[model samples]
Target: MSGLLALLDDVAAIAKLAAAQLDDVAGQASKAGVKAAGVVIDDAAVTPKYVTGLPAARELPIVWKIARASFFNKLVILLPVALLLNAVLPWLLTPLLMIGGAYLCFEGAEKVWHLIIPQKDHGPQQAETLDAAHLEEQRVKGAIKTDFILSAEIMTISLAQIEIDTLWIQAAALAAVAIGITALVYGAVALLVKADDLGVLLSVKGRLAATRAFGRRIVKSMPAVMLVIATIGTVAMLWVGGSIIVHGVHDLGWHLPYEQIKYAAKVAAETLGAANGFVTWAVTAGLDGVIGLAVGFILIPIVTRVIAPVTGWLFPEKT
Candidate 1:
């Protein structure tokens, strides 16, 4: 009887140890996911446009396909590459993240520029002119390619936040971050895209007058909602990109921009004692966004006039 009691206590202790390790993994994953929230938001924001003119029946299906591809991109490709880079070439992580940050800045600034002066080429309309199946295929392929870059950034950012000494714990944390963020972004995308349909259903089929009115409001508001979401995403990208570059440069031994931003945040925080933390973060993000926008504007002409043409010439389409 005494021997049995000892065995029970030992088993309970082992179970408790496993539970503690699991909690550590969860905590790390949550922290890492927060670090990559900006990219995740941008991904959710960007995906809905892919189904712009598709039939309502096709919207969810298309989102599902893209989500599947995004999962594969993050887990099958970026996750392993992130781990390998961390193990074999940890120093490269900061530089690569800076590159991604620059790209994000460029994209965000490009969107702003487009908002100021709308482009002539309507990609969705042009795609819609082709066969529906072909348009779907092309859109999915393009979305996947774009997602690969964003996924790499997300994975790298998440990995950088993890300071776990255990290899298995690091792996577990990364996997959780990847899976959670993918699900979150795609889930949000799905909801946003299907919102119109939901509204239409509610408006046309609801039994109560109030419910129907609410449905109409949803349908009416969807365009504005999408626009707001896009704007937020762009701002987040710029803020995140600028912050990344600032941190990258600081890590690489140039501390002026980062230190100045922190100083600015500190001054703001001092001005608002009660809300110091929030004020500090808001100030830092605002300054970082400005820097990101400045960098993006600089890159635009160089990318368009030089890089684009060169790349096109070097890698002409096979067809």
Candidate 2:
């Protein structure tokens, strides 16, 4: 009887330890996910557009397919690569992060520039008779390729944020983040894509007048909501990208910009008193965004003039 009691106590202790480990993994994963919020928000914001002209019935299915691809990109591909990089060339992490940040900034700035000076549609025009299936395939391929880039950024950012010492713990946290983010992004995309349909259905079929009115409001508001989401995503990309570059520079021993931004934030905080925290954050984010815009604009000309032509030349198609 005493021996049996000892075994029970041992099992209880093991169970407790496992539970504690699980808790730690969850906490770390959540922290990492929070750190990658900018990219995650942009992912959610951007994905809905791929389904825009598709049949309503196909929207959710396409999102599901992309989500599946995103999962594979993160877990099977990016996760392993991230772990390898962390284990081997950890020194390269910051530089890689800055590259990703620069890309984000460039994307945000390009969008802003396009808004300011709307580009003429100069490419070959779409056929009057659209091939729905071909279009769907093209969009899906494009979205998955985009997701691969974003997912790489997300995983890299998440890995950088994880502070655990054990490889297993880090792996667990990254896996959790990958799964959670994929689900969150695609789930939101699905809802955003289908919202109009849901609203139309409710507006037409709702038994209650209030429900019908709410549905009508949803239908009317979706476009504006999408616009708002896109705006936020762009801002987030710039802020996050600029912040990453600034921090990366600081890590690499260039502290002037970092110090200047910190000083400005401090001044704002001091002036705001009770709103110190919020003011400080706002100032910091604003400065970061400005830096991002500057960097992006700088890259735009270089990319358009140099990189694009070079890439085309290097990858010339076979006749």
How close is each model in CA RMSD to the real structure? 1.5, 1.9
How would you encode candidate 1's per-residue C-alpha lDDT over 260-316 as one tens digit per residue? 999999988987787888999999999999999999999999999999999999988
For candidate 1, the TM-score is 0.95
| Off by more than 4 A, model 2 | 121-124, 127-130, 316-319
The lDDT values for all models are 0.90, 0.93
| Structural similarity to truth (TM-score) of each candidate | 0.95, 0.95
In candidate 2 the C-alpha lDDT for residue 227 amounts to: 96
lDDT (C-alpha) at residue 129 in model 2: 46
Predicted candidate 2 versus true structure: per-residue lDDT over 230-271, tens digit per residue: 999999999999999999999999999999999999988997
* True lDDT of residue 112, candidate 2: 95
- Model 1, CA-based lDDT: 0.90
Stretches of model 1 off by over 4 angstroms after superposition: 1-3
